[model samples]
Target: MISSAPVIILHGGAGYWEGKNLDSVNSALREASRRGFEEFRRGSSIEAVVEAISFMEDSGVFDAGKGSVKNSEGEVEMDAGIMDGKTLSAGSVVLVRTGSPIRKALEVMKKGKHVIIAERKGNSNTTFNSGKGGDTVGAVALDLEGRIVAGTSTGGISGKEPGRIGDSPIPGAGFYATERVGVSSTGIGEVILRVLPAKEVDTLVSMGILLDDALNSVVNKVSRMFGKGNIGMIGVSKYGDVSAHFNTKGMPRCYQNKEKIQCLVFDGDFS
Candidate 1:
């Protein structure tokens, strides 16, 4: 019997983290993992993933939602995506200006009619920031029922062209999930978009690849193609295994299992 014990993993982003104040980043991941696991314990992976990401979106610690960077025109725009492994159902939103881009993504998923939606912006009375510190935020979860779900939310790179959408809202590019596994990606959206790291991991895992090896292979493949510092991923398998890999100097991340939760930043830097 598949143990009802749930597992979850998440990432802030892939970027130079050799030196930078990350107290807030670490705290956010820890809190997210704790809250996400609680939701997973009683609900579905979908709920847990959403609840976790929604917190980060409003945390003002990452390049999403409140912490979204401005475009060349100086306005906050964001993108988000969520996927259900059991039904292969997914939803995404792009170029939106709101305090809860993750919720908008969830709304699109529940809508069923459209898998993706775009917006010029929203009139949410929310404050914006320079988007200092983080890059993107994402999560992958395996529920007690063995179902998996993955989701990603991002504000894109700073000073990007207006209406420019990255991999965050694109299935297979930023996130993918199957009954067997779930994957979420962060870092250089353009580079990530080129290789579809999330889907690649799913394909490799389905083909008998170990979750850890598949995650590493994706990073190696991306590193070879685009060089290092361009990719990071988190994965959760139906059997409750989890993995995190990235080529950048740092990818703030954490994972929770039956044992415990560990949050990390620079290599060897554990909190």
Candidate 2:
């Protein structure tokens, strides 16, 4: 039988939005927490975490769903990915709009045959372009049933040229999950593309590094690979160990839960 403990993780993205309204950020945290705990209470699988986060991704409140960033040409492009740890199944979508790209990625994983990559198109209704304007967010969750899933959604890089798709919708970069570990990320898309922080972290854990140390290594590597940009991630091990890390001046927000829930915001000054 599976353990009664469930875990959920969330990220708000990485950037220089220091003076932005704190209330809005708090509200987003509340929303994320609500969805996360609801899934736990229902004894749902990791899929429920994806469904709950998809609501946030589609809410236009944070930066993953409706208010995501725009490219250099002022058009919105999106990316998303999902992975199921138990089955090693994964799916990803890029450069489309309409339905949630993360959801589409999960569908692809479930279908288990095709690799779905949304091509860049002028029309913004494709699954890849649905949540431009910084509306993109990423998630990783493990349910009481011991199922794990990871997902990410993003509106491309800020000021990016039209048709420029980042790694968030790509597996291994923005999100990754396995029976041994779970991962999700947020930060500069271009940087994320190069380092593939989420998967790298998982690899470290597999190599016998402790979960917290593994996460730190990935965060430090990201900082070394891409200078000055913020990157944050959360991970949970098969042993129920939880860890999170960030390399920027400030990481907006991150949360986790096993028995009780906790929310963290790392702003500049470490106070």
Candidate 3:
């Protein structure tokens, strides 16, 4: 039988977070990790990821769900994705106006017909931040059954055009899961979509690389391809090992298990 020990990792996003805002981001990351682990203890990896993401969304501490940034037209259009490691089943939604974009993604997974749903038309405009915004939220967990699962949610880039989709709603780009590993990513949606960061890490793990090493390798690749401070990722291997990596100046993140929880505002290697 698998051990009761559970592992969970979560990220608020990657960007220029500092000072007082860093404190709020840290608090939210810690709470999210704690909540996810709680659900993991209940033996549901899926629920753990969902609950953790929902908490972050509701916290209004990150650019997702309730506090999602407005688009060019001053409207909030969110994207989210969820994946199950055991079955490789996945679901995603884009341009959602609901308060729970992550919940909608979960529903898509449960429904199991389509892998994605996207809004059809363009709306109005606003000037949030455009290309410089680094905003996405995600979680990965390993449950007692040894299954790994991952979920990601985002408000899309600041000032993004209405109906524009980002990596958050793309499986293998923002999130990926398999019997071997699970991954979730945050950063520039365009860069992430180009590299499919999550799946790249899993591919390395499948080739016998350690979870941390795989993550580091992917971070290095992104740094070379898109420059530093461009992407961040969190993951869990089926063996309950957890990994988090980013090329950004800061990424609010946390990892937890029965033994203890570790939360940090920036990756040590990045400093």
Better of 1 and 3 by lDDT: 1
lDDT of 1 by residue, 43-93 (tens): 998999999998898888988888888889887889999999999999999
Q: What are the per-residue Cα lDDT tens digits for candidate 2 across 219-250?
A: 88777767666687767777666666777544
Estimate the TM-score of every prediction.
0.95, 0.86, 0.91
Q: RMSD of each candidate?
A: 2.3, 3.9, 4.0
Best-first order by lDDT:
1, 3, 2
TM-score of 3: 0.91
Q: List the candidate 2 regions with Cα displacement exceeding 4 Å.
A: 1-4, 41-43, 119-136, 256-258, 267-271
- RMSD of candidate 3 to true structure, Å: 4.0
Q: Put the candidates in TM-score order, highest first.
A: 1, 3, 2
